[model samples]
Target: MQRGLSGQYEIGSVVGQEEVRAFVPAPLPPDPLPDLAGERGRLHEQALLACGRLDAITALLPEPDLFLYAYVRKEALVSSQIEGTQSSLSDLLLFELEETPGVPFDDVVEVSNYIAALEHGLGRLREGFPLSNRLLREIHERLLARGRGAERQPGSLRRTQNWIGGTRPGNAHFVPPPPQRVESQMADLERFLHDDQQPFSALIKAALAHVQFETIHPFLDGNGRMGRLLIALILHEDRVLHQPLLYLSLYFKQNREEYYRLLDATRREGDWEAWLDFFLEGVLTTANGAVETAHRLLDVFREDREQVEGTGRSAANALRVFHALGTRPVASINDLAERSGVAYPTASRAVEALEGLGILREITGRRRDRVFAYWRYIAVLNEGAEPL
Candidate 1:
């Protein structure tokens, strides 16, 4: 299945200097998709089952959006980390709380922007916006609204040659199409996305679209993060999942070398089958893990709530605080009071009651303005979310 030269190369000069042969990836919905009738078929079945399980779990959550609040932030953290951002989930939570201490402002801003971008995309989809190049540009704008790549022409495609890996195009591992060809290449991709004649499964379309986006390398910066985001966006758009619950960043990060190799292999060897296999496996693994995490979180919340209920007189106020913690795993007393609609002293006493029941832990261990974490809840969501 080694189809030579995935796309034609064109001679182009970079920065008015050396001429480089830049690669322009062929348009998406790759023809015939490597024949998924054997092993690939089995993988596809497993992925579908896993996705069904995830949706079932999502449906069971008391408030899926509340879970999504933290879950999406976790995804943002992991996705940004793959691009070398050092912000942790705690840092993001702290930043969102507007109490930034010992956190890299720029890194946290980048992660926050990622969350904003995702929310914007999901909102637009809900409003019946088509997933086209225009939406991608909009998401890109929000993604780099602040932080490292803000000045890299946030909402626009690269107007010059861009390369991945090495310093210059001449020494780079891969050089994307020259600037002039970006629009035409992207137009082809858009058509493929909207094409009704070519029938492909939602999962197959998502996998192929992700690789094509990455190979196109359209943006001046943030292409990697944007490409990853497109996967979830496509699935959500196609109604494959009710919510944006599946994220492959952790899987991709763990399999960094193979992931890159397969992407390159798809370009070099036309090994779309290998990449699709990997993509489907990631779907299965990530979906199954999400379902398991959801179950564990529900158990933790139930067990902690029962323990809080055993506190008698203080139970009502403490239960209020505990529910708040379920939504925001990390919070301050002020946060608890505001969210729970109680007085500061009341919030403090409620927090103490929960602490006595071993439901919440003081993360800072300070006298005043101390931060408390729903340790078990956070720990359940923190699995595989550690910054790499």
Candidate 2:
């Protein structure tokens, strides 16, 4: 049966709020992570295999697909992040496009806008910008660049209280420390980012940061998604992984329940090892998945290039034509015109050229309106994954 999410606004399916402030959550407990999480032997073996496999394939690949991987993953993370009172795992996938029956859609366009900004921020990070609250605030602010919440540009720090879960007005599943507590939370967060006090490995540190930040719930919105992206950022910053091609969302989405449970458990039990192991497992799984995606993408690129080039296009034009692979993976003829910055006739000629050579596959049979797909590459992106 389909989910009955007929309501129009997002609220915690599990967490509740008493009007955002004056919220009270469950009792907090000490750390509960085991030193090795008992499942160590098998998990260790899997980790070794995962690391070796990912590194081997990644060694052959060059840059991150800034257009495909980073951008799409950012979109998923950001949508899942703030979604304020209503966001859910399933909602992340549809937030920007086709409204689903029984599911609410609001500020959809804004999600894309912020995702673009997220891409911009990631670009800056790769360029060596220092990470700071000001930087993050800027990203959140731009997230409102379009859509319903555009006026919510003051996406700045929260001055009021926010809660994670519950139904009663004053009760929440989780609540951040407080407005005054932001600074201390920031300090801890910053130190974790830059400090050498590796109470554990890079994998473990990543988990610790995630749990701590969620515990802090720094912003009134976007905390969950931002926290997830921050994981990839940390890995890249620390050189734990190359090229942020990871789709940690895939793992978390599959293990959604445990993901939240362990996050909550960290606060209740201080089970650092449990969370660390979980995070590592996610890393191992996603890293391997990403490698497969990369190879699949490369194959599609090569094949698409062949088809476009067979039309006798210049080598340089071949580069531009191959762009159809990622630029607008789903392009209408109009999209083709806008993207290539060409007149309708010129765009038509180009599409016909590729189509004749079997590069761009038409999706719709309609004459008046049509859509074309760079199926090979898109298939790779959409492979093994449903919407977030």
Candidate 3:
């Protein structure tokens, strides 16, 4: 964009326009990420140790339940990301919402879809399938679906140029790598993705790739969400984890300022270690948390079953109602009817049995318009029930 002396606006090539701040590639200094001294001095070791622990967790994956571990981890992530806001860890995990962040439901679903597509793409990358613009575009388009980035055709490259680091027209923070640099940066990163010996650990490689993507800031928007998703994708593709379930949004949401600052420090100063350590630690911590959560859910399911099984109602149907509670906590009898796939009277009987077992609490008192809740199960899923 060209600015007239009187503040008029014009567009032209930055190359020819002296007034435009033409982006020139600067010689990035050596990796200073190692200098993440005090807090994460032992981060490299911690990351490796965490990898070992997570590997053991994966090994515990029995044949039938191998994907179960992956699937539930995926559920935790999807539930959090789809219904979460840029807020507290408690809120993200519990999905507690007293006041809606006003994020549209469509945007939520779109981001979740992108997460799924990235999972698919990462699967291909793991098997040595070549990544193509078409695949990337398809994933990117799906990410943009029904959301803010819908301005552009889904997955189509911009016919016009795009830039970042600018806030207002008059003063922008940083210009993205110029157009010419985009192809090279992308290619180099892709090579790094395939490189077996990059003189760095997988943890470091994850950091480098993340920072590089953000620096490239390739897309118009959804870059932050996409970059985070890529962290999980890389971890899964490299066999660091058996599933693309590791997530850092919880950590990033917690330490948002530091996250941005360390990323910027990479460009302005070269603090690669700091960022890498953070990323690595996030993987381990999030992985452990996920494992614990899955086990907790299993325990909850077992206990709930023992409490309500053989209530003279259909034992399997009662169990189904409990499972449905995991998905919809505040459910009406009609909701139970749909989920249980039983007749209305049968569903009502099942709900009554659960209520007698204290498994469900009635929310609304109207006899006809009654609503029963799986209060305990929801409480287990949400640390504190605020709202969905």
The candidate with the higher lDDT, 1 or 2, is 1
Q: Which order, best to worst by TM-score?
A: 1, 2, 3
Worst 10 residues of 2 by lDDT: 1-10
lDDT tens digits, residue span 1-388, model 2: 1121110112322323223332112221223334654576467457646755665665675434523453364435434443432343234333432343344455344445546666766777888986666666777666655555555434577665566676542565765555665666666567556767544555556666777667767676666666776776666666665555554766776787998898766655546567767887887787777667667767777677766666654444444544644545556666667666666676777777777666677764668656666655555565434433
lDDT of each: 0.87, 0.58, 0.58
Task: Give per-residue CA lDDT, model 3, range 265-346, as digits (tens).
Answer: 7665555666676777776687677567556665665687788776654777777766666555566777778876877787
Model 3 lowest lDDT segment of ten: 91-100
Question: On a 0 to 1 TM-score scale, where does candidate 1 land against the true structure?
Answer: 0.96
Q: Over 4 Å off in model 1, which ranges?
A: 1-3
Regions more than 4 Å wrong, model 3: 1-42, 55-104, 122-134, 157-166, 310-316, 323-345, 355-388
| Backbone clashes under 3 angstroms, per model | 0, 22, 3
Clashing residue pairs found in predicted model 3: 33-272, 33-273, 34-273
